[model samples]
Target: MDISEIAITAAMASGFIAIHLMVRRLNFLDATPRSGWLSFAGGVAVSYVFLHVLPDIALHQREFADGMGVGAKEAESIIYSLTLAGLAVFYGLERAVKMSRGESRKAGEGDKMGNRVLYLHLVTYGTLNALIGYLLLHREDAGAWSLGLYFVALGLHFFTADFGMRQDHPEAYDRLGRWVISAAVLGGWVLGLVVDLSPVLVGCLFAFLAGGIILNVLKEELPEERQSYFMPFVVGVLLYAGLILAERHWV
Candidate 1:
């Protein structure tokens, strides 16, 4: 990547780490009090998928079909299949982690196993951040304003992810989780600079990311423990969705 691309990536990586660290410092908002913000963040993320990413994926799939002389419907089916597969993969990961946790608890190794699960989850999330960072470089030609908006949306999304992880593994997240994800964003950007992905591969990455975001956000919300504020959640959805739509029109 050139200096401009490197600067853009660095800004994004800095944003990721800064927002996360700032939120972590607010220890008073721990546990249930954080739910409203988490809900709002989830709404914003899910909106991005419905309004922005999914449409792009559809176009990419259509292009793939045309290039290969396949039926449009068939290509669409494949795209959705990949999305479902992505969802299933993360769901399986959660299930496996939970199962291991239960077994560990029974075996009197609960603390050790919990730490292991937290490590794995953080690493996986960090890898996802890296993927996103790397992908941002491809949008270098798309203008600065669009790129800025992308970082804004993603930085907000990362705030929620940080809060959720901290709630789940407070000590470990404090000790290592934050740094891991922060580094992941930078690492991913570096990798992106070194590698150019094909359209098909890019589509796959987005599909998997969309699925993961949907799953992770919802998983945090559904638990009865959250006591999330419904109105704020709806407001978040509308507010962020409007911003995204307005940005699209302005561009």
Candidate 2:
């Protein structure tokens, strides 16, 4: 990586760490109707996935086909299956947390998730954060502008994620979870600096991330309890999608 890439990635890392460390301070997101900003952030993240990530998956499919000497159809199926696996894995994790929390409540332990659930949740997201860090240096398009766009979309996604995490395990998340995940982000970036992964591996990771992003965003936005703002979400989708198209055409 050049000096500029280093600088940008460092900033991206810091931004992610800050979201974990500082998300609780953003009190407005706690509103009953749900914050427009969170909805807007969700929309931006989804737009990035559809407009940027899905298209990139086609490129990765080509890489996978070449690397494995497989047919294009077979490679495409493999890439998409990984995406589905990513979504299913996180969905299962979410179910586990909710079940744990429900069991705890039944036992008159209030709304807290059990220690096992808390640990599992933290470890899983920590790994995801690390993957984010690693991909900072190894994304499909490593241009400065691409890095900036990735940071913006994922940074906002982190806000919604942090909020949900805090909701799930208020005490545990505040005390220890955020720190662990924050360090994971930096740890993954460091791993990227030292370890060179194959293009096929990176593509697999990207596909997984795309699935996770879709699940996380929808889980937050689509629930009836959230009362998410539709107008802001629509505006976010239109604006960011336009920006991406413009960038592709001109930049």
Candidate 3:
């Protein structure tokens, strides 16, 4: 099998194993930390794309990418562009969506997971995960050192994101959500290899997540009665926002 197949299979098996453990171990599963971690897994998947793996791919490809220089400056420039574009578009959509409802961030209010919003979350999260997989697995052009570093970064990011999220929201997890998220992340990672579109597709992933984040931000402004399972996603989106903004304006 090729790299894609290997990556897909490993992700599925591992994710499933994680899910199974959650199901067997947790009682009153709905209030467990599993869901938060699951939600975080998705975020971690996306972060792997945005923070480490994607940049390495982008930098390596830049050399042959329309004659772009294979220099740190060029890599920084590309990351900056994606970051700015990602954050700007995210906030813009958030504002536009909020305008219709006269929304404001009142702390603890939740966004409605309307069909549009749910679809936004799934597609964006999937796309982000897929795009990263595409660049990393397909870019046979990358060296082992950078690739190893990228994987290390991905591992740490995933671990930290999941742990922190689990700590923040002790009530969001359960066996059902745990399996669902575990399946989603692992399955999503594997599927991403197959649906591997292009580097440009990564941009679409960011855009999709940006829309969902905007929706979550709107929800966060609502009254307590309206709160839901969206805060996890909102937090993930915010992380992406921070990373992208930093990549663009700060770094």
Candidate 4:
């Protein structure tokens, strides 16, 4: 990467860390009616996945097929299978965390999660952050504009995600989780600087991220308990999608 790319990636890495460190202070997101801004962030994230990440999956499928001398159908199966695996893995983790919480409540432990469950959640999310950090340097299109778009989408995503994390494990997340995740981001970026992986592997990583993002956003929004705002979510989707399309068309 050139100096400009390095600088941008560093700034984005810092931004990710800052989001985690400071998300709790965004008190408006904790509104009872479900903050429109949080919902809006979710929408932007989902839109990015559909507009940018999913399409990139198709390209990766083609490349993987070509590289492996496999047929298109086989490549699609391979790539989509990874996506499914990503979704399934995170779903299982989520269920485990919720179940842990429920069990704690049943035991009259006041909704506290076990250390094992907490560690599992932290590890899973830390890996996710690390992959995101690695991608900061290794995106398919490494232009400054692409980096900016990515930072905006995922920055908002981190905002919403941190909110959820705090709600789930307030004490642990504030005390230790944020620092681990923040370090994971910088660690992944540093790894990217020194360790080059195959393009096919990077594509697979992105496919996993696509599935994770979809699951994460929907889980937060679809629950009746959340009382999330719908119009702001729609606005976020439309506005970010328009920006992406305009960028593609004009830039």
Of models 1 and 3, which has the larger TM-score? 1
TM-scores, all models, native as reference? 0.85, 0.98, 0.41, 0.97
Local accuracy of candidate 4 as per-residue lDDT tens digits, 114-192: 7899999999999999999999999865666777888899999998888988888888998999999999999999998
Kindly report which residue stretches of model 3 are placed more than 4 angstroms away from their true locations once superposed: 1-79, 87-127, 130-136, 139-147, 167-169, 175-177, 199-251
Q: How accurate is candidate 2 locally (lDDT)?
A: 0.91
lDDT of 4 at 212: 87
**Where is model 4 more than 4 Å wrong at Cα?**
none
Query: Residue 45 error for model 3, in Å?
Result: 12
| Ranked by TM-score, top first | 2, 4, 1, 3
Candidate with top TM-score is 2
For model 1, what is the C-alpha lDDT against the true structure?
0.72
Give the candidate order by descending lDDT.
2, 4, 1, 3
Runs of candidate 1 exceeding 4 Å displacement: 66-69, 104-112, 139-141
What digit string (tens of lDDT, one per residue) describes model 2 on residues 155-179?
Answer: 9999999999999988898899999
**Per-residue error (Å), model 1, residue 174:** 2.3
lDDT of 3 by residue, 22-81 (tens): 443433323333354434434534554545444544554454244444565755466456
Q: Which regions of candidate 2 are displaced past 4 Å? A: none
* Structure candidate 4, residue pairs in collision: none
Per-residue lDDT tens digits for candidate 1, residues 45-84, read: 7777777777778867777587556888887777777778
**Candidate 4: how large is its RMSD?**
1.1
Assess candidate 4 and give its lDDT: 0.88
